[model samples]
Target: MLYIIDILGTIAFAISGALVAFDKRMDVFGIFIIAFVTAVGGGTLRDLLIGHTPVGWMNDLTYTYVIIVSTIFAIGFRSKLNYLRTSLLLFDAIGIGLYTLIGLEKGVELHLHPILCIALGTMTACFGGVIRDILCNEIPVVFRRETIYATCCILGGVMYFALGVLPLDHNIVFLASGTIIIATRLLAVRFKIALPNIYRD
Candidate 1:
């Protein structure tokens, strides 16, 4: 199941990147490049930060192929996505939920301090989109105080570790953690809930 969740997250981010490329009127290659970056950027950063040499996609082509296929499929079926209005945000939330667990578990395996593990988890869930926005010449959403983007991951990470001592099944913990991350994002958007704007004054 972890593998499946990872792939679904990959596909979601890939679609989001492709959609951004399409919005920017980029060519097919540009779309593919952005999609690939968005799909693997955060995980690669987490691996590097944790001293996992060569990173994940470097040794395995599975993620690469998934990104490629997802980009193509997203571009081909994009008209339907247009009608959804919030497709990009939705996909991004799903990506965050899945990637957080992957990073958290990797940190746990490396025996890092629990708080740093939570930081790693938040980075894994958000840094990809940060890179994506930077490359696309947009402000990184997580850097905005009013967005409540990465905070969802941070709060969800806290929840994950909080639940760790509860005697629940590990898989249940994982699912609940991911759900918390995703739900926070979705609900925040739904209610326009966000941190106070720093520049409002």
Candidate 2:
């Protein structure tokens, strides 16, 4: 199940990255570059912080293949697709949702503290988009208070721990947490919900 989620998350992130690249009018190479980084950037950071050597993608070429295929799919279908902002939001939300669960599980396996686990989850979910935006010369959405991006990951991570105390099955717990994360993001976007800005003139 985790493997499936990881693959799906990679695909979603790769597509989202490719979309951003196209929106920026980048070339083919640039599209692939952005897709690659967005798909693996967060996971790489999580692995390094956890002292894991030779990140997951480095150990397997399947991830690379998936990213390439996803990039192509994104670019190939751009014209046929609606190119709606909501589509991008949905894909990004799904990627972050799965990534949050994956990161939280890894932290638990590594015997990390709950707080650290939450942090790892947030990093795993948001770092990829952060790098993508930076490379595209835009502000990282997660860094924006109004984005409600990383906050979704953090809330989902917290929900994971909360659900852990229940007598539900582990699979159910993970699914519920991830679903909540995705739903939160979609709702936030639909309702234009966000944290209040702290900056004042």
Candidate 3:
């Protein structure tokens, strides 16, 4: 189940990255490169932070394959995606939610502190987009106060640990936490919710 979720997350981020590349009028190689990094950059950073050797994609070809397929699919359906208007945001939200859990699980496996686990979750969920934006020559959304991006991941992580003491199954806990993250992001976008702008005119 975790493996499935990870794959889905990878696909989501890959598609999002491909869409961004399309918006930038990038070539096929650039599209593939952007999708690949956006799918695995966050997880790679998380693994390295925890001293997990060889990283994740190096150990599993599945992620690379999935990203390749996802990028191709996105490019094939670029017209349909452009019509959706919110496709990029939707996929990004879903990607962060799923990756948040993947990172939290990794931290837990290493018996890390809960706070550190939450930090890992946020990093795993946001760093990919950060890398993507940097490569694309745009400021990362999570760094912008225009929306509460990474905060959603942090809240989801908090909720995950909060539910840890409950009698619910671990899968249920994951679903609930991930849902919180996804829903929070969607709602924030829907309502134009954001942290106050620090730079006053």
Give one clash count per candidate, in the order shown.
0, 0, 0
The lDDT of each candidate is 0.85, 0.87, 0.88
lDDT of 3 at 147: 73
Error (Å) of candidate 1 at residue 60 is 3.0
Candidate 3 C-alpha error for residue 177, in Å = 1.4
RMSD (CA, angstroms), candidate 3: 2.0
C-alpha lDDT of residue 188 in model 3 = 93
Angstrom error of the Cα, residue 86, model 2: value is 4.0
TM-score of each: 0.90, 0.90, 0.89
Per-residue alpha-carbon lDDT of candidate 3 for residues 78-131, written as tens digits (9 for 90 to 100):
888767557667767887898898898899999999999999989999898899
Query: 1-201 in candidate 2: lDDT tens per residue?
Result: 667767877888898888889999999999999999999999899999888889978999999999999888888888865655566667678879988888888999989999999999899899998999999999996787775888889999999999999999998988999998999989898888889867793
Worst 10 residues of 3 by lDDT: 82-91
Residue pair clashes in candidate 3: none
Q: In model 1, how large is the Cα lDDT of residue 135?
A: 83
